[model samples]
Target: MSLPTWELIRAAGLTSYFLLFVSVSSGLLFSIKAAKPKTNQLLQVAHQSAGWFSLLFGLFHGLLLYIDTYKPYSLVEIFIPFTTKDEPLLNGLGTISLFIMVLLFISGDLMKKVGAKVWKKIHRLALPMVILISTHGIMLGTDSSNGWAIVLYASSLAIILSLLIVKLLLIKAKTKKVISA
Candidate 1:
């Protein structure tokens, strides 16, 4: 038997959201590690290119929700989130996540003018935003019930979290070595 129409839409949305998440995370990781001149240049190019693609696909993913008639969502619900009477909390969090994503997109281009120190402070928001966005996806998304989606989401989380832990450990080790020297 063919899958239900709603299932297809959910799958599409989940896939698009996954791509957006990966693109942003990869861009951020590349940016943070890009210190050397040649590597920095390459990373910057990759970040910008991937960022644009993520934004484009993310917009399309959001629009698809509106287009899917089986579980049609209004423009307001699409943008505002949590406006859906059926699920207020998840939708509200999703709205906040969307706002954070917008800030990330805008601030990325303005990092130079904003000053590296100040931008670094602002960029810390990315971690929280990603967590919130992922939570929103897990809670409100239709694909939340799917085993594959859960596995993908969890894997992404594990990778990011592991990278962060390693980065911190390395920093601390370097600091200790410097003090001893």
Candidate 2:
């Protein structure tokens, strides 16, 4: 059976959110000094790949809305944050997240030109991007109340939060070791 247009939009939005989770989690591993070199490389690849996928899927979801007979969105609203008259705040959060993703993607290559420290700071936006994306989904997604969607969102949030805690602990331990040494 053929799927409805809204169903396609829902699937793309959910997939994009899932990809965003993968991208952010993989990016966090790069911050751990103790992470194995080989493992870090793999994580970098995953982060890059997932970031691209998430952006693409997000774009697809927004583009699908252009043809949505129920509620059409203009390009300005879809691409620009805070411009959508309908659910402006929620859509703005998502638009901001997309811009963050684009920056991170470009900064990966620009690291050489911009210097590693600058690039790293830019990439750190991933955490905030996650917040923006999650809030956008929760506030705007129609399928967000579904049992599966709730579980997915909760699981992703728990995992990312745990990873953040781990990164913080790792940083603290390294700091203490340095001071004691």
Q: Which number leads on lDDT?
A: 2
Estimate, for each residue in 42-159, the C-alpha lDDT of model 2 and write its tens digit: 9988988998999899889888887776777888888877998888999889888878878987888787898999998997888888888889998789888989989989999998
- lDDT, candidate 1, 39-146, per-residue tens: 766766765665566555555556666767567678788788678666777666666666766777777778888887876776677678668768877887766778
lDDT of each: 0.69, 0.86
Cα displacement (Å) at residue 138, model 2: 1.0
Clashing pairs in 2: none
Model 2 worst lDDT window (10 residues): 26-35
Q: Candidate 1: RMSD over Cα atoms? A: 3.8
> Judged by lDDT against the true structure, how good is candidate 1?
0.69
